[model samples]
Target: MKKTINSLKIPVVFLLLVSAFIACDKDYSVIESDVLGDENSDFTTGDSLWSVTAYNKKLDSLQINNLGTTSISATAGNLLGVFNDPSYGLTTASIVSQLVPSTFSPEFDENPVVDSVVLNIPYYNTVVSYDEDNNPEYRLDSLFGDNDTPIKLTIYRSNYFLRDFDPNNPENVSQKYYSNGSSTENSALNGTSVIKFDDHIDNISNPIYSNAAFKPSNLATITTVGDGDDEVATKSGPALRKLLDNDYWKSVIIDKEGDPVLSSQSNFKNYFRGLYFKAEANTNDGSMLLLNIAATAANITMYYTSGADGSRTQETYVMNFSGNILNTFVNDYSIPLYDGDKILGDNELHLKGTEGSMAVVEIFSGKVDCDGDGILDLDAIDCFKQNYRQLDDNGDYVKDPITNRYKLKKLINEAQLVLTELDNLPTGSVEDYHTYDRIYAYDIKGNSTTLDYSIDPTTNTSDPLNSKIISLGQRNDTGVFKIRLTQHLNNILFTDSIAENTPTTIGLVLSNNVNYTDNAEILDSGDTVTTVPRASILSPRGTIIYGSTQNTDPKKRLQLKIFSSEAKD
Candidate 1:
């Protein structure tokens, strides 16, 4: 049963005072006690049994571009390669990035000749130990799936231009892109008729770079230059450093020096376009990597020599992966059917990342019977008002004469949403762990963080992973997630008017980092689900958990448990 609270008149001055008091940094336990009177002398604490409904919702398309009007790149890392999940099926990640020349249209020495072009994209790694010779041993981080298995990698010259502002919008809004390349809406937004991989300039017949079988290695790279006593060695962490064809760079860049196309950034971008890093599965199970492609170390260097053969000087030109960079995902997963009871909620909740799935949770839904007469008389909100509000001699609500609203008799101390994972499901293979460490909750309508999440005292601004871990809740050893909603619930129950302060639906999704609260636009949803969690776009993982309709074990069902305090009267 469910219920909603009706509009009740409340004192504006009193509500203002309570709002002001809640904004302070004092401890909630002492604050609530002082606001509602002494706990031992006048108040008693107890739990409110409220109904919660939760169901799985699939995400068709999610925004991938981090390009804003003021910010160049808001995302942390770009995902690459393919991974096959036991439950969520296959996912392929690719990158489309715009490149900028280190120096625009500069005069090269007379008769310049291309020597080699080297592309270096650094991997997330850490130095574990140092050898006797002072060489460091490194371990790769941010890699998922099977490291031993190889995946097909291809780099192509992109013909499609990634614009900074939307041409269709009059206000010059920043152009947005989604992860799903198959979406016709996204194709239309790009002003291109072709979809997916067809947007690239190169084909299978002739690509910039192609490797049918490619895998990442953890060993440090050692480059030696010169010979004999003059020889020197440089050791660096593991990275994707490969030499490209010199003929290709000579024809594309060297031959066009001082041309009108290379004069400025606007003209250069249209002439060169960019590079597309496409990933394909070579085997049934492949590897995925989180690449720091926007880092200063990630760039393409063109090594060349200028001047006469007898007096040649070595020169280097660099191109950086910058401007408008975005990630594209090709997901092959069985879309879960939504036939479950909406009021009671579904039996299973599916939570996945990277244009995957999310869950909608509604608390205190529908009407409920307050009295034990076996008849539905009032809704849950009305029941809360009747049971927790002050009563008169005739057992009716004691209304304020000035405001004509029933005053709140109980103060909400804490409200927590508990989600338990399904133990029987296979999370991942023995080689890799696919389950996420944290799940974020936000207001569905506002597409923003809850009051509790915003006011979490333990939030560490410097370290994203450590921020709000206790308040937002991490996946425990038993596979349970607990999220606090104290301030959010208090706002709803203690508000002066029900019309303005009704309970809102909550959204739960897997987060790569809790500190990232920014929302990314959805392509085809037409602003209905306006945005998705930005942190969720960085990960490629999934998990299954119990919803609100677990019949076999009622205790395992999703619940909104609220601890409140009321006057001893």
Candidate 2:
């Protein structure tokens, strides 16, 4: 934000702001102060003059990983029958999860009777509203496909093991899959892969990750559970139920009684591997469903009668998916992006899905030469970084070097960040993410070796300072999310008592926050890592918003507005 002086005015009025800094409401007191009398008194009862500076810049793509969560989003935006997102294109996601071994081997009764071998995957439900019948309507959390709609889904045995991680590749050492542009040739993935990508045909050369023709499968039916006798009003929701193939289950688990692989977790993981759940739209114009395979009640139960012949009681061999970090189950998005013809010409930005473009916004993405170089290139130009001429109490420019820098001494009352969508955006049926309660400002600085700010290396999901993302809603006429960046901006503006400097660059994903936060998966160490999911469950359907780079209207572009006050020192 550039501040200009009024040169025309002869007698400049320098109003003295002398309010008690300790009194609450902070810097806002200046705007509503009603003190009269001496305009030059140092102890006047008035609000401080809180100045606002709007900083806007086009975001550059930064390297991010450890997002860990994969998403399955198939949407067709049809209000009538089945809804599909035709504008952005339809995409079905698949997942392959590694099963942690059973605690102990159980002996079956003589002539064991097989009742049923069923796989139950619970749907994501957050209790929100109730229906007319007083039936509890569940709000699906990580679900993005058409609600109350049907889509074809299948489960398969993965021929290849997920070579995403190993003991050689630790958490500190990030893998190539985490970053979009990391070195793939030397990705530390030792073993060969059996899963093939059929993207390139007879002539095409590039191997696509989304192509899943190489894997073998069995179909799983998606149906609503608790509809019949198992009706528990509170926990009633949809599920993907599949009867296990008798021969396959027996060979993998039942018949392998004395096998050493079944005795150990690591050996069994290498021998049998995991199951892949694949969802498909069938046609280009069908609906999609978002089912949470990592939910609490989702598992495969091997039903068998272990009781004596006359007694006959049922027993189960449960195959629970204990989300191991090394397993690396993820969503592979193969959807089309919002490629407006105009954007190609001007290189303009358009924020969309995970498969689409992401906006890289910064507090001050603009560059400046802090070392007094003739040209500006590296350092960011902002109120915190930029050096200015010292100002006196009379509001006149004072020649001082030591006290010239801006000091964030007072309490940071608040800072509002408003990101607006372009008027000439890609048109289509976009989910008001507010309704689904899915939008977040992710600190995507997972694999960055060098950043201007000091980020905690402990967790990659959230920044140490700013963790929660709360949407302020569409405040103005244009569709914009008014995000409160008080804590985020405060850290940037003020120097932490411990660390002398800030991060060089920080990443923020304006995507779904829940996908990165709400997780029911536990690691091998028995630690619950809910900070970030192994994959995102955000639907491929999305919205296109404008960046600060667009100059059509200054008021409609992305900008960071900081309202700060100076303490009465």
Candidate 3:
């Protein structure tokens, strides 16, 4: 077989062929050739006098399977919090991170004296407008709360220990914690959580009427923004600075009487454990802060006086939050993908991300019950079976009777899958504006199952490419993620009849969370387990899209374009 170059100039073979149907009125003049079989056909196996044809067509149906297994990521940015969205429902997000050693010296010298402890988090001003240069014109200095809807943010000691891999076997790199509650080492609130919500200047809600709403929290800031000579060299505006209990950390950092455990990062981690941030709405209604937990400026600062009263040398040991990969982020969406009151199956779908819902796609199988007749419709099944054939049922290659091969006037050089965006994104807030970068098709086949395939992200990172896995491109201007099903399509088109590859339906995932966690789900991608790493991008928001149920706009629906080579008739 001769190799061919696709539109991208990559040397590869396309294993996508389809049964012909005369539905659309394509230009009759463009029809250069066609393959027809009659009783006179006697073409054998090895024939060199044949022409190969290539063309394009769309899949008949794309069933969405609601694959609601474990959904979460390995790495992410921003510490999530509590908020009540009137339309979307309640959202609660939090941060679980490892704290490393701040100073290697392990000693507090110069007559150390306690000053204060604070947790600084920053957020953006709710969208006002932009200037000609695209800078935020008017900045409303506020955190995430408004209308004094009290939201109590609490800090607590993490109940679970975070490890890079399995703690039992240091050599085992597989067992690790994930965003979705799967791993055994998941951290929960087992200890007491101290409420850190007491920096209000004045509670004047008595004077202000209930009709008016105002922000009630610390600032999310940039440095250098204060009054006259009192202007400090350091900057602190637009930051959520919560005063942590001075006595608690003082016991751990200073009051320990020069504890040697605090000297080593590993010793301190085991002894002190870590911190967990939880947000409780208190009431069912409140605002949630969109925080950059991974911000270079975000931290927990411990201030101390290293010298005497008037001559004290003010020094600080900062607990950096975003540096370690051991950190785990979580987002809880209170709303279900389907209406709680209604009952629906996998065929009827819903897709969402972040603190939102999800839509699973069904694989191409199963029969239809259109006329309320439950029995599998024979005519419909026969039609589907015929349309999916690569060769005629009699075992003869589908080729021209005269030339002994198939050829065509046209071939599909490129095929792309496109999706439409729903206009239901939240307005005004910059944090809510961005969605996920890449969408993934997860393999759901487990062990004892013949469904074998591979999925590798061929973009963003430096991972090598595997031809067996179909990689979907990220969303473009048309609001759809164009995917390349070249490799997977080849398997379905050319495999032997006895051992046809089991095709797996894929779920749209925000992060590249393609881990073969379930023993049943295995990867025969032919590459090493080391090279096929599971990587993902963080998506803080969700969006609505046209599902297979929608019948309005032709472009908005889910579609698949197959580029195949045909035996010219």
Output the number of the TM-score-best candidate: 1
Summed backbone clashes in each candidate are 6, 28, 32
Pitting candidate 2 against candidate 3, the one with the higher TM-score is 2
Taking all chains together, each candidate's TM-score versus the true structure is: 0.83, 0.60, 0.53
Which predicted model would earn the best lDDT? 1
For model 2, give the 10-residue run with minimal summed lDDT.
Answer: 74-83
The runs of at least 3 residues in candidate 3 whose Cα sits more than 4 Å from the true structure, single-residue gaps closed, are 1-75, 83-88, 121-150, 157-239, 243-248, 282-296, 307-312, 322-347, 354-357, 366-411, 414-503, 510-569
Candidate 1 TM-score versus the reference: 0.83
Model 1 spans > 4 angstroms off: 1-42, 67-75, 181-194, 221-232, 308-311, 334-341, 385-407, 431-436, 460-465, 496-503, 526-528, 550-552
- Give one digit per residue, the lDDT tens place, for model 1 in 74-178: 225788898876677778888888888888886778899887899998887878899999889997776778888899998988888888887887999877776
- Give the distance in Å from residue 299's predicted Cα in candidate 3 to where it truly belongs: 2.6
Candidate 3 residue-wise lDDT, 138-174, digit = tens: 3432133243576655556653454444445557743
The digit string of per-residue lDDT tens for model 2 on 329-359 reads: 1223234333233221122334433323444
What is the full ranking by TM-score, best candidate first? 1, 2, 3
